[model samples]
Target: MKKLLLAGVTIAMMATPAIAQTYKFAVVPKAMNNPFFDVARDGCLKRAKELGNVECIYKGPIEHEPATQAQIIQDFITQKVDGLAISVADVASMTKSIEAATAAGIPVITFDADAPGSKRIAYIGTNNKDFGLALGKQLLQLRPEGGKYAMVSGGPGAKNLAERVDGVREALKGSKWVEVQGSPTFCNDDSTLAVQQMSDLRTATPDLAAIVPVGGWPMFAPEGFKAFVNKNKKDIDSGKLTLVVADTLKMQLELLRDGYSNALTGQRPFEMGEKSMDTLLAIKKGQKVPEVIYTGLDLVTKDNVAQLLK
Candidate 1:
């Protein structure tokens, strides 16, 4: 009887399955304070929960600072995270850090903004140039006659925003629209500065025909943007000034409905966050993944703003 009991215990031990290994992935955004990245953080956490044995560590600088972001990546490396996903603030700096992380046997990927030169396994975000083209096309549709325009952007070093700006320029090629001198005033991810820049640009170029913000920096501060629009209501209503910004955040959509903006081109940060984890997991398993995974874009205008809000 003792032998039979021992034999049964051994069989039970053999039948039990082994516990799966838990993967710790760190999702680093450009700025933790930005609402856009907040959505991405939510997605990362949601996917991590759904994929049991996966832990998502989301961390980044409070503001958009390349040096600070680089330091954060270094810290993650020291912590020996299993994988890394970054929304690069500066391509050059992030490339070096990503290479270091890869050399340490950790897989790395980029999302939202990419550092193509880096050793990252894949890029999961929008086709920024295409996004820019869409913005340009939208502006053209709004003001076909063409006029002097300026672009507002966050962090001048951001590759994604630069691509969008280039795309806007490419689409406006041969059109009546001309970019204003010293255009694309950089806000460095400061919403308040973004509003001030826009106001200043308008003041400097009194006849500035249109304004395109590759990212919705100003609209992040709803009240400030509203004030800016109200101050310029005369020009906006008379069709003397046109506003075409990026991102379809709730407040931005509201501003669009209120006639503060003419058009909006948005990106899917949530999807970017979710896919960043999926791609990193595949990399860890030695599975093949695309070099570029475009999450896609959303073109919002007066006609469809209502539907999107719903």
Candidate 2:
């Protein structure tokens, strides 16, 4: 009887499935202060909980500093994380760190912003050039007989923003719209500086017909952006000046409804975060994955802002 009982216990143990290995996936965003990235962080955490074996470590510089961001990546590599997903702050700087991680036998992927020259396994984010084209087209639709416009971008070294700028230019090619001299002022991800630059650009070029921000930097600061919009209310209402900014955050949507912006082009940062983990897990399991995974974009205007809010 004792021998039969022992045999039954051994069979039961053998039939039970072994626990899966837990993966520690780190998601490095451009900055921790940006509310836009907060959504991404939520997505990462949600997906990690769903997976039950993925530990998502979301960390980055307090602000948009390439050097600081690179240091964070180095620290993660030293910690020997199972996989890494980064939104590249500076393409060149991030590429070096990504290559080092790959050499260390760790899988690496990029999201939000990409470093195409790097040895990273895959990129999961928006096709920024297309995002820019959409921004330009939105502006054109608002003020089709374009006059003068200036672009506002986050970081000067950001590959994503540069592509969007180029795309906007491409979309405006042969159109009446002309980019103002000394346009595309870089705010370096500072919301205050972004609003100031907008004011300064408008002051410098009185005939500036449109202001296109490839990213919604100023919109992050609701009161300040509201004040700026209120100051420019006459122009915006008269259609003499148009504002087409990127991202459809809650605050941005509110501003759009309040007539602060003409149009908005949004990226799915949350989806980027969720998919970053999914892609990294597949790579860790040696499964096939695509080189580029575009999360898609949202073009928001007064027409859809109400429904999106709900």
TM-scores, each model vs. reference: 0.95, 0.95
Q: Give the TM-score of candidate 2.
A: 0.95
Model 1 ranges with Cα > 4 A deviation:
1-14
Encode model 2's per-residue lDDT on 248-283: one tens digit a residue: 988899899888998999999999989988998998
Model 2 — which ten-residue stretch has the worst lDDT? 1-10
Q: List the residue pairs that clash in candidate 2.
A: none
lDDT against the true structure, per candidate, is: 0.92, 0.92
Predicted candidate 1: what Cα RMSD to the true structure? 2.4
* lDDT value, candidate 2, whole model: 0.92
> Which residue pairs collide in model 1, if any?
none
lDDT of 1 by residue, 34-77 (tens): 89999898999999999988999999999999999999999999
Model 1, CA-based lDDT: 0.92
Candidate 2 residues lying further than 4 Å off, grouped into runs, are: 1-16
